[model samples]
Target: MPRLPYLSGVAAATAVVALLAAAPPPSGEVTVSRPRVVAHFDFAQGQTPENIALEPDGSADLTFSAARQIAHVTKQGHTRIRATLPAEANPRTPVVGDDIVLGIARAHDGTLYVTYATGTRKTGVWRVAPGGAPRQIAQLPSNGLPNAIGLDERRGVLYVADSVLGTVWSVPQQGGTPTEWAKDTALDPVPGSEGGFGVGANGLKVHDGAVWVSNSDRGTLLRIPVRRNGSAGPIETRATGLGGIDDFAFTGRGDTVLAAMFLDNELALVRPDGTHTVVLTQEDGLSNPTSVAVRHRTVYVTSGAFFTMRDPNLLLADLGERHDR
Candidate 1:
């Protein structure tokens, strides 16, 4: 999804929230993280970290969206470019007209997969093998905006969320022809910035036995079960009141979610019962937090600074801190 500058969308978002003001009741008590900045980015160099895939060794693979590149960052904050994507020839993209990379996922064998959206001939999913060049594995719709990607390692398949077209596509982990895995009005963008590119289904994750998706425009999280026949089952609205949600990751604590709300500059702790709490915010060095990844008791958050256009960074927080309420 082409992002709106924080300046342009804040007032509109505030007005919308004021008119539809309601919060979900908290499910129960839970401990949250206190975030601290670990690494910073320079926007002029196109170093915005859009999504993250953590390695077994604690390093991170990131999609530098708008940079058209995939990069890696060490646990100690050292960063380097892995591969730069091909330039879009006819760069007329929908929404913000950016021909950039979006989501990324790392395979168990260290093979890295990323999504590119140019709204042109180059829009597709690309694979970057270990010590190899990036190659296109699946061709998505040029008119659609493919955002976050999720890997089902057990099934050897990948699921992509199309924010513009409101569809979730399925492709082989090794790259093949894409298939429309699921379609519903529930995934369509009906609110927020950009008329044609409201960008509904922005983030995706294949957790447990279902494909979990975040609807940015509708302010809800959805879960679609994968049936025994490998087809999409029923769609369930898992959470609500998350107006500007972008990408999210599940913590080890049994179905709990840590989500990034880029539009609101907030990190939310969403529980299994669809209730959530604002655990971190702009005060925690967040400038439009985009993605979240969890490893043990540590949480990784990527802030692209798309709205602030300043101080794009990686923030870390330690979990397991309990607060009774």
Candidate 2:
């Protein structure tokens, strides 16, 4: 196991709440049925809200990648900083060019685990307890771009998806060296990805006794069996054709998923049968949505606005009568 770095004595920042307005739905899409916006970014809050985790009280904890902070959103639609990443955690590599926090997941006990990259070579995961400074938990490989994370609390393990390396890694919940749990050709980048990022295994989730992941470039969803012996088994394709899939959450129905299609500027409802429905689109006011979180029948989405970095927002809508089980 690699030696874990102790990040201590980093000054924590005070929480900042911002006043925001309800974003009107995009004009032309008015006739098209889709999820409506409940909360939109005020720009005074933060930019590039990435991944979100649902709190016990039904609020959401969001990662603001560009701002390098974790924010909490109340169920009633208010936003505030929950924690801030220390300067040392920011990556300084040329490949990625900027320090960005990508994925966040909450444990049952309320600890938040985050994946961040300063560059491809400086990727790591941090654990942040409520009202505490972030602590480095594991250091990923220098060549891997750590993105989304998933927790298997029952097994006391954490799973991280490395988009650049096309691999999934497992780390001890208590903090230790990460091991490559699974990798396959299906996790590779699809031909002709626009950006140099080459995103492969992006979003991750542990559900139904398996580890599910999405390949952003390929837009493929796959699952790896978790054996009784605590090892990962063969990988299997669950669904595909979800272009530019980023972070996603499972829907109320088994085998159904709500995914954020980043490049397509849409929200997608995908099933194991390879059929997908565009629940929201650019015309519906989604601008480069990077993540999705579902709590009961309501769905929350974060638009990073990566291209323009303008009008980035957190949108919400109820899972109404449209979806099929």
Candidate 3:
């Protein structure tokens, strides 16, 4: 498992108190209401789900970051191992104890793309076919730490975010050398931030003729224009101060987004106007949400519980009627 410096008893208590104080009041009307839990993981499964992908049948394909495996959770709540990383694929590096699988994207043809890293020197993006071994698609730079992946199916390109390098890379769908697609100051860590976990550009998604990405340390969301010639155009900021934004998904509405705030231990509903509201929080059983996936009116969130007091869980919420408010 990825380890971090431990805090003393007093320091830990102080951190908890500080977090509680920073949280918004439990009772307050917001544009999007809190969602209810639809499923959770039991103690038997020692998996820390990091990213989520939806199957055609409504099942969820999750990346087990710590477990070094991929798991499938059916709509009926049954869990099964879809694939496991080989030991060689997750060798230990200087920065982390072992390579942890982070980003995951499913193609229309049922292929799964996963990104993993132990340290800058050993990071890679892989393509996994059903019932087949993982194939290394692209090897990132020595100082690049790939975090999230998004596929542009129409153009046969895969976009990946490099957290440490603060850049987005575009690779051929069939696997080859990656080229820098875009890089900007907005993708860098926020000024005055303590720089916890060394994360910056963390999430990537393709939506509405553009590619969307989130800067975890900077707490910013950006959209990169995708040109018709399969190249990237200018980058634009969509939102800021989103409280440690992570992997997010569109709500199928006008610029509405469901974002996981890792540091805040909450889920935020962000609007196109750059305003946001806390829709779900730790009080609602979110330990440290890392990603959110939406399918129609149903929402699924994966809490890694990376540095929290609770265990990891896969939660579901229904946006059926509450989303309108």
- What TM-score does candidate 1 get on C-alpha atoms? 0.92
lDDT of each: 0.84, 0.74, 0.75
Q: Scored by Cα lDDT, where does model 3 land?
A: 0.75
Colliding pairs, model 2: 91-118
| All candidates in order of lDDT, best leading | 1, 3, 2
Tell me which of candidates 1 and 3 scores higher on lDDT: 1
lDDT of 2 at 104: 92
Please give, for residues 156-190, the per-residue lDDT of candidate 2 as tens digits: 99999888787899999989899988988787664
Clashes of 3: 0
Candidates in descending TM-score order: 1, 3, 2
Q: What would the TM-score be for candidate 2 when compared with the true structure? A: 0.83
Residue 202 lDDT, candidate 1, scale 0-100: 91
* lDDT by residue for model 3 (77-194), tens: 7888888765544365433446678789999989999887765444678888988888788888756667788988888889998877878999899999899998887776544346
Top-TM-score candidate index? 1
TM-scores of all predicted structures: 0.92, 0.83, 0.85
